[model samples]
Target: MTDDLDTPVLDNHLHLDPRHGRGVDAVKDFVRLGGTHLLVVNKPSWHLGVEPDEPTDFRPVFEETLDAVAAANEVLPGRAWPVLGVHPGLISRLVDDRGFSPEDARDLMQGGIEVASEFVADGDALALKSGRPHYDVSDAVWAASNAVTRRAFELGAALDCAVQLHTEASEDLTDLAAAAEEVGLDPTRVVKHYAEGRLAGLTPSVMSEKDRLERAAESGEPFLMETDYVDDPEKPGMVLGPKTVPRRVRWLLEAGYDDAVRRAHVETPRAVYEIDTESTLNRDT
Candidate 1:
C-alpha cells in the first residue's frame, strides 16, 4: 500500500487560506499523500466589507493565492495542481484561520503559515487553554458575499477558467448557470467542489456527487475531485507519528471503503491539481 502512495494521488480540499500560511514547500507534504493536485479553495474571498479593524493582516484570500499554488505545483513534475475558486460563507475579519491557534496566528499571518501540526502539537495542553474565535460581521459582509460571488464568476469566465466552490454553493446553481450562459458556456463548465459525506442536518452530499457525474456525462464538463481531509475519529486524524504519507495511506486502505474513491481522493486529485488534463472516470458507476 505504501508503495502505491508514491504512484500519485489527488486531494480535493486544499485551503491555502492566508490564515493557513502555506508556501511552495507545501507541495512536498502534499506529495507525501500522493497529492499530485489540489482544489485550492479561495472561497474566503467573498467577504465584502466588515473586516477586522485590528491592523492584523488577513491572509491573502484563496482566490489571490491559486496562481502561485498552481505555479508551485508545476515546478514539481506530477507533483502539484491547484483548483482555483472562492470559498463560501462570509469572511469575517475576526475569524480565526487555524482551529485553535488564532492568537499565535495573529502575529504570523503577515508572514506565512507553518505546518498544521506545529500549531496543534501541544494538543490537550493547548486545547485546554484555547479560547473562542470571534468576528464582527456588518451589512458590509452580506454585501461583500453577494459581490464576490458575481466578481468571481466574471473573473473566471474572462480568464476562461473554472473555480472550486463548496457543494452547498449548488443551492444557487441556477445563478451559476446564468453566469455561464451569459458567458456562452454550458452550465457544466462550472466546477463545484467538495461533494461528499452526509453531515447531520446538512443535505446529503452523495446526491451532489451523483449530480456532478450526471452533469459531466451530459456536458462533457471536466470536474475535479476533493476532500476536506476531515479529522475523522472513525478514521482518526493520524499525524506523521513515526509514519510517512505512504504508511498512513496504507492504514487508510485497511480502514476500508471504495478503492476507486480512495485512490481518486489521494491520487487523482494530486494529478488534477498539478494540471494534468486526464479524463476523470465515474468510478461510482
Candidate 2:
C-alpha cells in the first residue's frame, strides 16, 4: 500500500469497466491508496463492441457506466463521477469498418451529443466528453468528426456542462478558447484529456508521468492529473494505474510542493468539475 497523504487526490479520468473483473475491489484499493475521487468515463468500444452484430446502441452502455459510477458511490459514496459521450474514433470506425456513410456517421454522432446533453441536464454526468481529432482520416471524415465535436461544445454551452476532449497529443489548441467563445462555452470549461504540454488558454487533464507531471508542476499551470487507466485484464494498468495520481501527490509532498499538489488534486478539479471532495466526504460521513 502506498503511504497516505494529508490531502486527498482525485483521478480525473479512469475506465472502471466490470468486464476486467476489477469492480468494487478496484474502488476499495483506490480509496486505500488515498484516492478520494474519480471520474469514470464510458468508451463504447471497451464496453460494447466495434462489430456490427454486437450491440451498436450507445444508450445502454452510457446507462451501465453511470450505474457503475453509482455503485462505486455506494461502496464509497460521492467518490466517483461519470463522463458520457461517443468517442471521436468511433466515428471513423463506423465509416470505415461498419460501412456507415459519412452523413450517417455524423448523424449518429449528433444523436450521441444529444444524449450526452440529456445526461448532464439530468445530473447523471459531470461533463460531456467528445472532440477527439483524428489526423489520419480522409478530409471528409475529418471534417465530419470535427463538426460533431463542435456540436458537442454547443450543447455543453447550452446546458452549462464542461466538454472533455480526447485529441492527438501533438494537436495545437491555441484556437480552442476562441472557438469555444464563439460557440458560447467558457474556454475554461473545455478540458483537453490525456494532454501533454500546456495549451495557451485551455485546461489539461494530464497523464501521470514523472517528467510530464514535473514539467506541468514547474510551469505552475492549472491542470489535473489522470492515469487514463483502462483497467483491462490483458493490459492491466495500460496507461497508468488507479493509484498513480495519489502516488504523484506523495511525491509532490515529499518534494515540499504542497501548493502545487493542492492545486492539481483539489482546486483544479473543484473548479472544473464543480465538486468539493471535503464537503462531499463530510456529507457522506
Candidate 3:
C-alpha cells in the first residue's frame, strides 16, 4: 500500500496487545500500509491478563499501551499517541461476575478513570477512552455506567484533552453531547468511536471502511477515520484491519477525494486533539 504522497494518514482508535496478539508487528502492518499516525488506545484490562482488584492495577495496562506507542514511534516517530483509560465494559464484569454492587463498581471505574488521567497529566498520553456498555444492561448498571462516563468527561475537561467514547451505536448523540457539556467538557472534543454515521453534532471517528469513508467524504462534514483494530488473534481485525485506513485513503485519493482525505486525516485530528498531524506526519519525509 505504499504511496508517493506524504499526506498524513491517521487511525483514530487502535489497540496493540502484545501478550495476546500481534502487538508492535500489527503496528508495522499499519506503517507498511502508509499509515502515518495512530491513536493507540489501551485494551481491556482483562485482555492484558489483569483482573484489577483496585485502581492501581490498571497502571500496568496503561503502561503497556504507552510502551507500544513508544515502540511504534521508533518506527515512525511522533506518529502514535497513547489514549489510556479503563474500558467501560469492565463495569459489567465487576457488577455481574465479581458480584460488586453497581454503586461500588461505579466507584471502582471512576477510580480507574482517575488513574488514567494521571497518565494524561504527565504527558504520557494524549487522551482518554471511556463509555458505558454497548450491550443490554440493567437500569442500575446503566445509571452507574453513565456516572462513570461523566467522570471521564470531567477528567478530560480538566486535562484539556479529548475523550474517545465507545458506547451503543446511534446516529444521534444529543444525550452524549449534553453529558460532555454538563461536565464542562467541550462536546466537540468528545470523539464517538466506531461511529456509523455523522453524529448529530459531536465529532465522529468513523471506522475506515470504503463505503463509510466515501459517505463521510461526500457529506463534507468534519470527521476522522479509524480502523479500531483490536489486534486480537482469535477475532483478528474485529472491527477493521490495521491497514484499512491507509489502504482506503489510497483508494480515496485515487478516487479524487483528496480534499476530503486531507480534512479527515489531518485537519480534523488537529482540531479535535490539538495535534498538528500534517507537520507531524510529513516531517523527515
lDDT by candidate, in order shown: 0.35, 0.77, 0.87
Q: Which candidate has the highest TM-score of all?
A: 3
Which candidate comes out best when scored by lDDT?
A: 3
| Residue-wise C-alpha lDDT for candidate 2, range 1-285, written one tens digit per residue | 534567767888888777555866777777767777788988655346533323235677788788789878865533788998888888777888779987788888878778767888998888988875546888788778778888888998898888888877753686666778889988888889888846665798888887777777887878888988876777877789877787888887887778878888778878877878766753232
- Compute the lDDT of residue 60 as modeled in candidate 1: 40
Against the true structure, candidate 2 has what lDDT? 0.77
Instruction: Name every residue pair that clashes in candidate 2.
Output: none
The 10 consecutive residues of candidate 1 with the worst lDDT sum are: 124-133
By lDDT, is 1 or 3 better?
3
